[model samples]
Target: MRVVAIVLLGVHLAYAGTHSLKYFYTGVSRGIDFPEFTAVGLVDEGQFMYFDSNTMKAVPKTEWIRQNEGEDYWDREKQKLIGSHQAFKYNIQIAMERFNQSKGVHTVQMMYGCEWDDQTGETNGFRQYGYDGEDFLSLDLREMRWISPVPQGIITVLKWSYNRAELEGRKHYLNTVCIEWLKKYVEYGKSSLKKTVSPQVSLLQKDPSSPVTCHATGFYPSGVTIIWMKNGQEHHEDVDLGELLPNEDGTFQKSSTIRVTPEEWKKNKFSCVVEHQDKTVTEKEIRKNNASDDSSSQRSIFWQWIWHLKLDITVG
Candidate 1:
């Protein structure tokens, strides 16, 4: 009940060298209306598998995974998630007792992942736990030890630290098994993962007194740059850059706003430039808001604009 949604943003690498595989497991206490336990698996920031107590099954979220993995694979994943779900239920109770909390919503979460840099042949692994939106414990892979940020987690750290076999098994999985699986998934979805789509850049202005916003959406790979130029030179003052956000279809959207008075804008040539992958969009290529646009299309764009603005405020 009252599930804690964890949004993990992948590091946008300038080069296509780094790739990651991550898993998030969330367990909530009883007396809530939602599922007690839910798990998600992501490869390169794209969700590929999901499981929940209500479904009692692990399902593939991507066509590539469904095509590449057989029923046996889903069965194994389902069994593992079921076991984890039971453990999370018990752990949530224990955590409540430790915190002297009862009869209220509480959450136990685990996030573990591995990252590989193919070009440099570098690899890293991490495993961390959280309770009630705060860090509870984490594993130091290099030192092969558990660490707790809160006093309530000390007991768990002590108990898990003594399990040498489990620690070793976890280390093996993170360093070896996890990396192997990540590589396989990358190969399976290489076509979709590696493809790129150019963005549709637009210049939006609500009114003469409002800031001019450069909006770019429907870009692939989630990496793009937006900038404002004044009189053929890059202008940074009074500019706000928005965070990259995912569209409903898995592409990305970003915005950059420049504050310039109407007089200054009219006196000088101001431009918005967007760069993505190998393409560069200049002001000459941007679509401007116009009255000729259909009302329905304009309404859709207005809502999207408002949505992004709200998201930017929330994320800030």
Candidate 2:
């Protein structure tokens, strides 16, 4: 999958007890075929709503959200995003000017979100901006101030920080309004968001000299841990963990590879242990690539595993 640099705050909390509501906004310079501006909303790491410059309307991506929300809700969201679209376009131009860039592809992105721990009743929120894949500015909620990482963003920080009332309002929305909506969305889609599905674990090896790959697929909630064990002891060396990727069915998949020579492999017991929710999958044997397996079929299946990771947005 071709992953973008847009960071998602609190998305890793897509676990059993923690829930997150996040938004991502992107603005691009001219010459790109992609949308000039786009927005997306996610709940528990599943996309629920989306809007783009071409569409100019906020549309629900999930059936539950579409069924529960009325026309007025959609209309209100559309109007708000339309305004944001214009603002982002202007912001992108301003950013380009600040960086003294005349042309080429440039992107400005914003990510903000709230996380709630149901078991502990704890809540947290964050807002950050990026320019050309680098951090530009962010909100310091505790101090109620804006912080800029790049020199180009210092002007924006100084100007935005002076607005005390707006800062207070932003803080209130993130801490209060965002949490309320997240709870409502969770209730609306509890059947999907709260459900847990165990993964189908497999141990694959292309050749005798290749590293052993432990693959887990079709897992829900995406909070999974994969580790290598040697002689029943936790092993950390020569392990490479892959990113969690979404499946076509809305579930997730991940892989962890361990490098060990054939001689060492036979000398000790090596195992791959995967833990998701309450289920555990332990595999001690390797499944070698079948001689009859077609490479083209494998390539097709690999492309089928790739999917776009959508961005998200929420009205404060």
Which predicted model would earn the best TM-score? 2
lDDT of 1 at 60: 79
Model 2 clash pairs are 23-312, 23-313, 24-312, 40-312, 40-313, 41-312, 41-313
Model 2 segments more than 4 A misplaced:
1-16, 203-213, 230-232, 238-240, 257-270, 284-316
Number of residue pairs clashing in candidate 2, backbone atoms closer than 3 angstroms, sequence gap of 3 or more or interchain: 7
Cα lDDT tens digits, model 1, 1-316, are 1112223222222236788888878787787776888887877666678889998999877777888999999999999999988888888878888889887987777788898887897989888787776677888989888888778878878888888998899999999999998888877877665567899887887678788888788778776889898889999999999755545455667788888898998898899989998799886333445767424234345434322321100000
Cα lDDT, all candidates: 0.73, 0.75
Per-residue lDDT of model 2, residues 1-316, tens digit only:
1222222122212445889888878777788677888777878766678888997988887777878999999999999889988888788778778889888987777788899998899999988877776677889999988887668777878888898998999999999999999988887776554556798887889988899988888788788999899999999999989766555456667788899998999899999999998789999888875546434225324433222222221112
lDDT of residue 132 for candidate 1: 76
Lowest summed lDDT over 10 consecutive residues: which window, candidate 1? 307-316
Relative to the unseen true structure, what is the C-alpha lDDT of residue 50 in candidate 1, on a scale of 0 to 100?
A: 82
**Global lDDT of model 1:** 0.73
Give per-model TM-scores.
Answer: 0.70, 0.77
